[model samples]
Target: MSINWDLYNKRLNLHGSTQRDRLTKEFKIAKESKASSNPSCKTVKVNGIDKQVFIVAKSDKTKFSISPVNSSDTLQMGDKIFWKNADWLITELSLDDDVYVSGTIQQCNYTLPFQLNTSDIIQEPCIISDNQTTVGQDQNKIITVPDTLKHILIQYNSNTVQLQKGKRIFIDKQVENPSVYEVTKIDRITHMVGEHGLLELTCEEGQVTEKDRSDLLIADYVSVLPTPPVSDLCEITYSGFPEIKVGTSKTFTAVFKDESGNVLTDVMPIWNVIVPNGYESYVSFSEDGMKLIVTVASEFDLIGQTITIKLSNVDNPDGITLDVKVVSLF
Candidate 1:
């Protein structure tokens, strides 16, 4: 047997009133409860702005209250609410589990700035994620111009529903010499309960006018490359091995070679090492992800223990392993 909950909605309208102006209004709140399942919305003052809050508790399946606002406000994606005086950001919205809502606790109410090209041709608002410039390491010479890549986020607007990949957008608010960008990636957010959607876009930073400030442009353009074929019977080659003595330091550059002697640089091999007790710092990888450094302390008690190393590739799960001796005196 199903239960029916009769809910009541009270709307208060104040007119020229003091704190103790009780029961002197021409309009009184309706005092009858009605059975309804349709979601309702109301605007509340939050941070000096009127924010729409939703209530969907009539059809709640959880039996218990998942959100404190469920009794008064309908739940929606990206809804902001306060609990115990702390602000919470609504990350997910669902009604399957009794009108569930989930999100992270925001330390404070914050607003993001918009960087958009405000022209009559395109008036939709968009924001840049971050901007960055490359260090001269790739060029190996004196760089004249800085290379940049921009990560852009464009919110889904009900007015313009035709936005897709490869669409060009403006970066600045100026129409005189607008900075344009071609969208590359579109990250879509979907929910099983609500119809709200958010789009995360990636763009290649385009030409900017010399008159504009350089600091306005941000993001790094990383080239997406194809992966190489998986290798069989891969071999792990490194330097300075056979016996790692205590109190000594050695560096090893490990590279995986295929059956045809071709180095598999695209296939990232997982490194797995096992060291005995007290020699935990015997092996480590370099910051550049190319070389491995091994430093064993002389005070290690387990002298004859074996150190095993395994390098694995995704396509070839059965990886190769190498064994080394742990020596105390040389």
Candidate 2:
């Protein structure tokens, strides 16, 4: 018999899924939970200004309670949350097992200003904080930006998101010679069917040395972002469960790569699962079709059964087929 989860949701005063609508904040979250998500998010204004999230939880000094926020996004890492009159950065993303997308948030100190497609600097509302070490590294910080401007600080990758990772720009163009910062790192925050739009960036203050002065130009306020190199698909790597567990679905994934081991994110891979004539199996695929899942009813389906799955790409007719076996965990 299925356990009545509503009994537990009520004991917690969640009132079922209605808890997300009750005493929750409205956030501009992503529309998709997979790759190819949108990043160029336009802010939503309430009462002539952008919306802000306020936490009433007394859980800790900085940690917010597990209250739900209204948004279409998957609530993943690299997504910023405005809190405590300051913008706090989300270091961990929520999982499917989570009771609301709960995680830790540190205050942001700065914003990685952007000029989408060489336009004027799009002053991002919230802060992103400065980095000390490696580019695109995830670290824990107690940092924060002013809370008056509350919003999530989402960053997009320089590749599929159409921006340059190393592009340089001025925080303010009005100043005679404003400070320059270069985007040294980027992380994709939005998810449509796939990862897309506003990326998290790790920018370091840039210097204008005399040797570099001649290279500066008036027409080009910022360096043009470079497009990712088009590489031929060289190999495919398959990752899957060694054996199918009882009463559990197993997932298998394929990673397309080039000769240099760089992931080829542009390809569309398809999966095919086959079982023996007497066996019954249910199959599924991840949102981006990069993963395949297989599940059988019980030992009845396992009797005299052998399972196999193959990966292929329709676009790349030359792509090789990978055959992997799936045996019963029992």
Candidate 3:
């Protein structure tokens, strides 16, 4: 059957209208983007051409035409926008085209661990020595003599009965030969009476008399008498101040005690007083004097006054006690 041109044209028009309606329906079904919830959104004027853009509701199905307004409202997907003013950072973007921009959002930053300079830290130096040890471990052992060998003497006999003076003798039992005895004294006989000649012998102790012969003997078993050991004879105890004003007397008592702490009474105590600028004075006492009085002259008027006093036994002299003190007379 032959088709009519006019009828075909009319049918074409109807189909075109139907197709347009269908496209419109499809565009309406497409999802639209929504505005961000950030409150910083504001309306600003866009200087460029006006354009219609589709904005989707939060449901994503509804579409709205966003026309450019004078003020930009939070630049939502549905809002009309013309121009952007300044460069603003975008903080959040929603899947539905919601944009959140921030002007005051801080930039990315980081902090490193704290460090100290050389001046801030302090270090102390220490002395370390392997040679340094405890006190008692380094002390010297004291020498002790057996009490049984404290006193011993030996005598020798010779054909020359007269002995010289000031000679020493050595006696020991371990040697095979007899030890030698030096002659310490000599006695000359001048006369012979009757049938016997007079004889005499002398030793270092004194002129050996006939009565002293009982104490002398010639012996095989003998040893030299050991010298008495030296010990701290006395200690001086202080009972006074070291410094005194000029023309003023400072009285201090010194107790003379033996090693056993017994007061030694028969000896005199000697003292030496020293002033600041090298002035020295000596003071001594009688056999019964234990306390000493020291007087200082007023010529030494200096700010840090210092005085030294030394005390000792006058007879023994080897043992000593020392004391020093600084005082202000001003």
Candidate 4:
């Protein structure tokens, strides 16, 4: 082949010009194409404050981005993106290439399984690992835990509004001793996603039973008390009274209940002790009005005295009365 340096140089220049023209045309076409359409702008309340953001999305996964029209509001991580029938948490953001946004899909129709340990009085930390496999399945299903999950975050739909952080909720897995869980944290900001926000719960260690597995799959979610207690119902109860010695002390616990006999888990009964006329110096009540302490002096007049310690509350007139006998061995 004959070597033509001048012709080779000219051909190289022409090819470079053609490639530049094609690149420019492709860029113009990409810029003209809409990333997403029919964008919806909404204001979500975060921390009792309103934040406005626009969501631009389509049914196709590739055709989704946040705030395509308006640049004022930007989508950040932890912001929930509701596209189609599924809920997705924004995990990545890209402003280049006509704005590419993507996130992992959180099943809207499924509730995360939480196991609780009820063997002890204090609840154990919630076990949310994805190691357990279901029946007929060789591999375990993956579950996503929020980055801010120091506690259990239960995402509730429409039927879980009554669930609050301080209220106790029932969890039944058909065990002999069913355990109740307390709501620990409630994410008020991301609550604007679907039906309601997410709830943080105190969970113990356990596995989901096969019987309740259907309920979890069907999105029954978790049932909570429709009406939670707000105030005290003014009912007090305690164990039987014991013999009062000269120098011994006894501790008692009073349980408060409501009109429907439901234990007042949030209320503390106000107690007032009315000791016998002469026995006032021997018997006294605690400062918080919950415990009754007794101390008999050596100079007490009667060793065998039948004293009536009236445990009453002015606010709640329906109180109990116990007769404690004071005995001293000389």
Question: What would the per-residue lDDT of candidate 4 be over residues 1-330, giving only the tens digit for each residue?
Answer: 899989877876652457666565554445335433323544443222455444555576543444423333334433444444444444334434333222222323323333232211222212132223234433565554433222443444332444455444334444454444445656555424443345434433233343333333211234443442423444233344455566655555555665567765554455555556766776654644555555555534646776554444444565665566667744
- TM-score of decoy 2: 0.32
Best by TM-score: 2
What TM-score goes with each of the models?
A: 0.29, 0.32, 0.25, 0.32
| Candidate 1 Cα misplacement greater than 4 A, ranges | 1-72, 78-127, 131-147, 173-178, 189-194, 208-330
Which TM-score value belongs to model 3? 0.25
TM-score of 1: 0.29
Model 2 lDDT tens row, 69-130: 33432344535455436555544434552334444455556544555556344544434444
Tell me how many clashing residue pairs each candidate has.
13, 25, 19, 4
Candidate 3 or 4, higher TM-score?
4
Which one is best on lDDT?
1
TM-score of 4: 0.32
lDDT of each: 0.48, 0.47, 0.35, 0.44
Q: Write the per-residue lDDT of candidate 1 for residues 213-283, one digit (tens) a residue.
A: 43433212222343444434466555655667767655555576765677767767666778866667644
| Best-to-worst TM-score order | 2, 4, 1, 3
Q: On TM-score, who's better, 1 or 4? A: 4
